[model samples]
Target: MAIGYLGPEGTFTHAAARELRPGADLVALTTQAQAIALVEDGSIEGAVVPVDNTVNGVVLPTWDALLGTTASRIVADTLVPVTFNAYALTGDVVPEVVVSHPHALAQCARYVSSLGVPSRAASSTAEACASLAPGEVAIAAPVCAELYPVATIATKVEDGAGAITQFGVVSRDDVRPTTDRWTTVFAALPERNAPGSLAALLTPLASLGCNLENIVARPLRGSVDYVFLLFVTDLDQDREASALDSLRAQCSGLSVLGRLAAAKHSRPDGASGIPARLAPVRS
Candidate 1:
C-alpha cells in the first residue's frame, strides 16, 4: 500500500515513513496537512505527519488538521532525530543565503546566525536542498546530500544535541492488535464559560488511573471556547470505559482520535518500537 509523507523525499517525515512502512511505495506531498487529508479521503492507505518535536514543541498545523479530520486517526507514531546539516552546491562553497523549513531554521538558529547569512523559509528542508541556488546553503536532513546535488558543508548544524521530531502515522482502517502499552488521544470541547469546566473534564482521568501525558489547546473556530487535545496513557480497558462515560458527561464534545502504542525513541536499527491497535471510538 502507498503511504504519504510531508516530503519531496529526504525529509525527516520521509525517514519516519520509511521506518514505519519499509518497502511500501512512498508518496511525497508538500505539507503535513495535505498528507493527512489524503488519508482521510482514502487517496492513500496512510500518512506520516509531524505531531511534536523535542526542540519546537507541538506542530500546530498538525493539531489543527487532526481537529478537522473525521475519518483519519493516528494509528501509530515514530520519532526522527532532527539532524540538521548545511548543504551547498560545492564542498568549498561559502553561502550568501540559508534556506530550510521554518522549524528547521529555528532549531538551528545559533548555527544559522554564525553563518552570517539571511535565512529563508522553504516548504520543507528537502525542498530547500532540491532547489538550492548558487551561493545558497540549505539546512536539511543529512539524507538530502545523497538525494540532491549538494555537498554537506556542515554536520549537526542544529543548536542543540539529540533533537527529535515525533510523527504520527494516520490511517482510516482499524489497526491490528499489538502488545505495547497504549495511549488514547482525543480532543475535547469543554462547556464554554462554565466554572471549573476544564478541571472537571480532566479529573476523571486521574481518578480512573489514566495518566495524561500531554495536553494542548487550540481555539475552537467561531467561538471563544477552546478544544483540548489530550494524550492519555496508563489506560486499563475496564477503567477507560468508565473514564469515557464520565468525560462525555462533562464535555460538550469529544473526538477520540486513536489508541496507539506509546512512542519510544528511534533506535539505531531505525525502528520506532511502537505498535498499533485501535480502540472503540467514543465520540
Candidate 2:
C-alpha cells in the first residue's frame, strides 16, 4: 500500500512517515492539507502530517484543516526531532533572504533573525533547500544538505533544545490501536451558549473515569460559532464506550475523529492526582 507525506523526501514528516510505516511505498506531497485531503478522498492509503510541536505548540494550518472535515481519522502518530541546519551554497555565504516552512522558520527564529534577513515561507523545508539560490539560505533538516546541493552553514539552528514535533497518520478507515494507551480526538458543539455549558460537557466524562488530555475551541467557518476539539484518555478501556456516550449526550453534535497512540506525558501518572489504572483489562 502507498502512504503520503509532506515532502520532497527531506522533510521531517518524511522521516516520521518512515518511522510509522517502514517498507511502505511513500509518495511526496507538497502540503499537509493536500495529504489530509488525499487521505479523505482515498487518493492514498494514508498520510503523515505534523499535528503539533513542543516549540511551536499547535500547528494552526494543520488543525484548521483537521477541523474542516471529520472523514479523515488520525490512525497513528510519531515524533520527529525539530532540528534545523541553515543551508547555502558555501559555508562563508552571507544570506540576503532566509527561506523554509513557516513552522521551521518559527522554530529557528533566533537563528533566522540573527542573519538580519527576511524569512520566506516555503511549502516544506526540503523544498526551500532544494530551490535555494545564491544569497538565499534555507533552514531545513541536515538531510536536505545531502538530498540537495546546499551546504550546512549552521547546524542545530532551532531556537529550543530538545524540541520535537508530533505527527499523525491520517486515513479514511478506522485503524485498530497498536497499544492500550491511546487518545481520542473529537469535535463537539455545546448545547447552548452558556457560561457553564463548557464545564458541563466535561462532567460526563469525568464521571466515567476518563481524563481530559487537551481541548481547543476553533471558530466555525463563516460564523462566530465555535466547535470544541477534545483529546481524551480513558483510565479504564472498558469505560471508553460509556465515556463517549456520556460526552455525546451533552453536546448538540459530536464527531469522533480518531483514536490514536497517545503522546508521552498524556497518560495519567501517580503524581497527576489522577490514579493510574492497576491491573487494567482490555477486551
Per-residue lDDT over 98-150 for candidate 2, one digit per residue giving the tens place of the 0 to 100 score: 99998898888899889998888899999998889899999999888779987
Model 2, position 73, has a per-residue lDDT of: 76
Per-residue lDDT for 195-283 in model 1, tens only?
A: 89899988988888788888998887798888888888766566556767878888788877766564645334454424445544568
Off by over 4 Å in 2: 234-236, 265-283
Q: In order, what lDDT does every prediction score?
A: 0.82, 0.80
Listed per model in order, the count of residue pairs whose N, CA or C atoms clash below 3 Å is 0, 0
Q: Which candidate ranks first by lDDT, i.e. highest?
A: 1
Report the C-alpha displacement of residue 94, candidate 1, in angstroms.
3.6
Error of 1 at 257 (Å): 1.7
